[model samples]
Target chain A: MENIALLMHGFAIAFSLENMAAAIFGAVAGLIIGAMPGLGGITGVSLLLPLTFGMNPTTAIIALAGLYYSTMYGGAFSAILLNIPGDSPAIVTSLDGYKLTQKGLPGKALNASTVSSFIGGTIGIIILTISGPLLAEAGLAFGAPELALLVLFALTSIGWLLGDDIPAGLLATAIGLMFATIGVDPALGQTRFSFGQINLLSGVSFIPLVVGFFGFSQVIDMIISGEDGAVATKVRIRDCVPTGKEIKMMLPVSIREGIIGTFVGVMPGAGATTSAFLSYIIEKRINKHRDEIGTGSMIGVAAPESSNNAAAAGAFAPLLTLGIPGGATTAVLLGGLMMWGLQPGPLLFTEQPDFVWSLIASMYIGNVICLILAFICIPILVRAISVSKKVLVPIIIAVCVIASYANSNAMFDVVLMLICGILGYLMKLADVPTTPMLLTFVLAPMLEQYVRQSFDMTRGNPSIFFRGGICWFFIVLILLVSFSPLIKNFYLKMKDKKAN
Target chain B: MGYVLPGLSVLMGLYWAVKAFGYRLWVLNGPGGGLFPLIAGILAIIFGVVMIMRRYRTKKKSDFSVKSIFPVVSVIGIIIASYIIGLIPSLGVFIIAWMVFYEKEPWLKSTAVGIGTALVFYLVFDLWLAVPLPMGLFELI
Candidate 1:
């Protein structure tokens, strides 16, 4: 009964004229941006984050929520029409999505993809609505030690999952954590690495860093490694609707993948790409038409499309409940919320119940908006994909420069953003994962505060971290997550040796 | 190129680690401000050293491609331009230069894009969002 009342109140807030307008605008803009290759949810969200500065946190988040889900939906358009995937999550979608397009069922493939994306997104949001509050409620029981351990677990998981090169990932994470330690210590008021610079005293600004990391770095990439222009396929509105038999065939598999996607999304560091690929593999194993997965199979198109969208929603679970971002996109969202002076996690639920619930309500509305807009806007969306790099690149640079300065009204931050952008480009060159670094930068201060608090309470006894069963559980969880890659590698090596 | 950045990072990390050690690491009751930083600096140094060692062992090619310099130069150009003439004019100038020289667009089109972009930025930042962007000489106007 309480849940229903809160939900209704949330609907009242989300359905406001301004909030509704923001949601629609965000969905359309996100769809347009996400269809462009090399710019997906993270870039779209990061680029648009500055616009949210003047708005209320609820209104800000509702728009961002729309952008977040619709970006995932929009990513499929390019993957199906062009052989190119818009983002990592769309890579699997392209395998069969493009194949189907090649086979002259472009309309059939697109319709199935759109319907499945909506189904998956709807399931994920429903689960998030119910599960998010429960998770946050459970988290209200945690103390500093548990929170600190949770951050540690998240960091390690990010280092493991986000890294293709483990050592470099670990190095990037270490560097990021060190960067977070600069400026005055929140607990002790003693400056560590500010070097007496006034600007450095406030610590690194989040927006500048994010803009440098995602926005500036991408511009650098586009310049250095020139990319081919986008090639778009034409689609007719008449062919956009799937047949009844096709819908029936796709429904069960889409639901299964949606469930799989939600579960994968709820895990820290597990993202849409992982969920989509895992569901694709699982579908091939369980379904009798396994051989047809990559060969223009409708089942193949439905499976990954559904999973990726669901995973995008699932990725929100940890972000809202525990203040831990599950992937890069959510990490950007967490930063945006923080910029608005709104902290995510359990306290946010109690303190800003309206903000939290309204954002959730907006997600439900945003999904429907995405379903409708994604279909209605296909012709326009396809045209958006073919924007040339020459025009876009210089424009991006100008925007980055403007946005960085606007964030703090300081030229020093513009310089700082540029420096970080250069470093980000270097890190990419070295094959170091940027996600670990980004997340660690966000989490390090919180982790430090918790560690210090726990130690103070226990009078320097480290064992206080383990006194609680939850903290111990996190400790074990971190251990498993950190070493699992090594264990897997060893197991694989042994199997290879046995076969030899 | 691969080892250059990591080597520099190692030196910086060690310098900070020593500097951080001068502060109170553990204040009798609990860990102090310098404690986490000192640990972090030391870890950074270790990671840097590991990165350097791995680079040496792998014998990875660290050739500096001329292609990479184009973007860096472009970024530096924008920064210098923005600093000298103010942000809006500098943006207009930079876009024109980028489109004409690098992208090989026609002068007319580049000028149009440059002017249009500047106008849009003016309306959006100054008019709509009210962001006080650096106007340089334009501020006098």
Candidate 2:
């Protein structure tokens, strides 16, 4: 009953002319950014962070979160038409989506992708509304040791979960942590590695780093490849409609993936990219018509696109409730919110119910806007892609450098951006999962603070790491997962010997 | 793949494990602020070294393709030059020219497209967003 009243109140606030316009604008912008390869949800949201400077936190968060899900719809366009996945989460989509294009089913594949994204995204938003408060309460009782352990668990899971390249992933994560500490020390009121530079106080700006890594790097790709990139064909999309058979086939799978993805996304560290990859794998295993999965399978495009966007919505639960950002872009949002003097936590739910509730309402509104925009404005976005890369790459790089410099008007940021861009490209070449790097960058400072604070509380006792039984459990969980690679390797060796 | 193992081992040997003393010496009386990052850093390095020496050495390279690397390098250079040439209008002009010519769009169409995009940028960032654009040689109204 209260949920309904609160929801109605949220609708009242969300439906206001100003907020609605912002949501609409955000949807359109997000759609475009999502379609551009290398520019993911994180980069798109980070660019809009500054634009939210003057708005209310509720409205700002609503607009930004709206963009996050809108991308799932937008990412498929290029993947289908050009065979270039716009977002990493859409990589699964490219398999069957591009194949569909080759087989002259591009329009049908696009419709399945977008409509399923809307369905999945809506499910994620509702789960966040119902369960976020409870999760926040559960986290409130966890102390510093538990928090530290949780962050450690997150690092281990995200990195080692890649299965074969666990060590390289962890190393990339460590490098990201190193980058996180490059500026002034957050505590102790002193600078460590500033190297006597003035602009190192506030550390690196998020926008420039993301823009360079994802946005500029991709623009560079377009130019280097000499226009052989996606959208190379003169594909005239047919009736962008899924047949009833297609719709019937997708409804159950999308729902299952949506539920599973939202559940994972609400957890502190799991997010859209992981969810999309995992869901696509699961979809392939369970698909009734499995043979078509990687070759013009409509389910392939629908499954991941739906779940990935749903995961985007589910990620906000942690950000809103426990003051913990589940992913990179949410961390950027957290930083922006703090800069505006709004501390994220349980109090955000109670004192700023409108910020919580209206933001939820806006997700519902945003999903609809995304559906409409994707259905109507794809041809418009295609025009942007048609403009060619010779001019586009340099213009984007120039804009990215300027954007970095303008974050705080620091020249140092521009330099950091170029270096990070190179580093990002190198990481890509080395197959070091950028997810670990991104996750570590967001959580390292907080993890550091939690450890230091816990040690201080216990007055330098190393054994304090396992103070309570709950803390002990968390510590063991992290340790076990971190060392699982060794166990796996040993098992494989034994199996080889037995076979011989 | 060769770079992977070396990178990991080098990071392990050079960056964090050696910093223990400097960190302890620098802030003897303060909190053990460097402990977690130090430990994480060391663990990361050790794991990396282990992986490179053992796992990396055993792996084979079947997916290697270097046919199109030079063009990629050139494009990256063009991007860096975009920044070195002062961003905004000049870089925009350069990007447009490169795309049209190097990417092989016709000269007349490229010129029109370049001028159109330049005008759009002028309107969007300068007029609308209120960001100041570098006028440079075009400063004379």
Candidate 3:
């Protein structure tokens, strides 16, 4: 009942003209960005973040959050029409979505994806609304030790699960940690590793690094890959309407996956891509039309699309509750929170109910807005997707440069952005995942502060970290995640030996 | 391509570890500025070495080409040009140059895009946001 009152208050705030405008703009931009083959939520948010600097924190966050989830909807456009996924999470959608297009049912595939995405997103938001404050309430009990261990678990899980190479991912995490140490140290206020440069004293700025890694590097990638001009498929709005039986088939699958994807998104490091893959696998195993899954069934289109959108919504719960990022995109959002001088976590809910609830309220609006815009603007969106990469590449580069410079108005940061962009591109070529690095860079200082505080409380006794159930739980999870690769390797070897 | 990043990581880890020792590792009972970096450095070195070894074992072929260097070099040129002309104009020139020379779009279209984008950025960043974008030699004049 109290929650209902708070939500109503939140709705009052979100209903403001400025906040509504922000949400609408974010939704439109997110859809266009998501439909672009190379851009995703992270790039969209990073590029637009600098523009929000002058706005109030509540409005700024609403806009960014709107963009974040709507990208999940927009990502399906290219996947269904062009047989090319707009982002990683949409890769599974392309499997059946493209098949449907080949069968001249592109409109059906798109409708299934859109409806499921709406259902899944709504379900995920409902779960978040119920669970977010509870998680924050639970977080209030966490002391320095528990917080430190929890951060360590988040970092380790991301490093372990992100890519094929565990060592590479761990190396990225270590590099992020090393970078975090460059500015003033949290423990003693002593600056280390600044290399005597004035700009280094404040540490590497988050905006420039993020823009470079996600934005500028993408520019380089586009140039290298060379643009394949606009997608050729066209869809009329009337053809997009689904039949009653088709809706019936999609509704149950979407509801089930929506629940499952929310849980997956709540877990640290398991993001929309994981949720999409997991839901698709389950759909393949259990659905009556399982054999038609990869062969262009509506259930196939519905399953992953709904789950990924749900997962995108689910990611916000931890971010809002604990200040820990749920994935790479949320990590960028976390940095945005800090940039606005707003510290996230339990205190945010208690101290800034307007900000928390308003942001939450805006998600419901954003979800509906995304569905309406997606349905009404399918023709315009297809035209936008066909915009030549020749035009997009240079424009994106310009945006990246200006955004980086706008953060601190320092030419030095621009130079830093260029350097990071090159390094990020090189890292990509080496097949080293950059997401772990970005996540760690955002979280490392928090981890360091927590660890230092714990040590201070215990007078250097490390046993303080193992004192509570929460600490032990995180410790066990961290250890298991860290050794998971080795366990998998051993199991594979044993299976091979047994077969022989 | 594969070895380069891990190899750089090894060097960076060594440098960080060595520099970290100069800062006090411990301050009274708790850690000081250097402790976290020292640990991170050591872990980086260990992981970097393992990455190198794994790469060696797999021996993946490199997909890198000189074409990848074009964007990096072009951006460097833009930065240098920003100091001479100004950031907005340099970016304008970058767009025109990129579209004309590289993408081979029509001169009129490239110029229009270049000028139009620069005008929008100036309005948004300078006029609205009020970021003190560098004027470079233009400021002196």
lDDT of 3 by residue, A1-500 (tens): 77778888999999999999999999988988786544578878987898899889999999999999999999888678655466767767877886786565677887899899999999998888887756434435567887788667766656433545667778888877887888999777878888788999989987667667666776677677664432334445566678898899899999999988887677656578767866776787588878788778889889999999988888887888788787789999999999999988778877999998899899999999999988876655445434577876787778777766776778788788887787788788777766667667766886888889999998999999999898899899889877977898999999999999
User: Distance (Å) between predicted and true CA of A314, model 3?
Assistant: 9.7
lDDT of 2: 0.67
Backbone clashes for every candidate come to 0, 6, 0
Across A168-201, the per-residue lDDT of candidate 2 in tens digits comes to 7777676667656655553454554455777766
Identify the leading candidate in terms of lDDT.
3
Which tens-of-lDDT digit does each residue in A436-497 have in candidate 1?
Answer: 66667776886778888888888889998888788889899889877877898999999999
Looking at model 2 chain A, report the run of 10 residues with the lowest lDDT sum: A228-237
| lDDT of each residue in B1-141, candidate 1, tens digit only | 777667766776787688777757877577777776777778778888888898889888753466666656766777777666888888888889989998899999999999999998788667755667776666677
Where does candidate 3 stray beyond 4 Å?
Answer: A1-136, A159-163, A225-363, A370-382, A429-431, A486-500, B1-3, B47-61, B137-141
Q: Score the docking of each candidate (DockQ).
A: 0.43, 0.29, 0.55
C-alpha positional error of residue B66 in candidate 1 after TM-score superposition, expressed in Å: 3.9
TM-score of chain A of each: 0.60, 0.65, 0.61
Judge candidate 3 against the unseen true structure and give its global Cα lDDT, from 0 to 1: 0.80
**Which candidate leads in DockQ?**
3
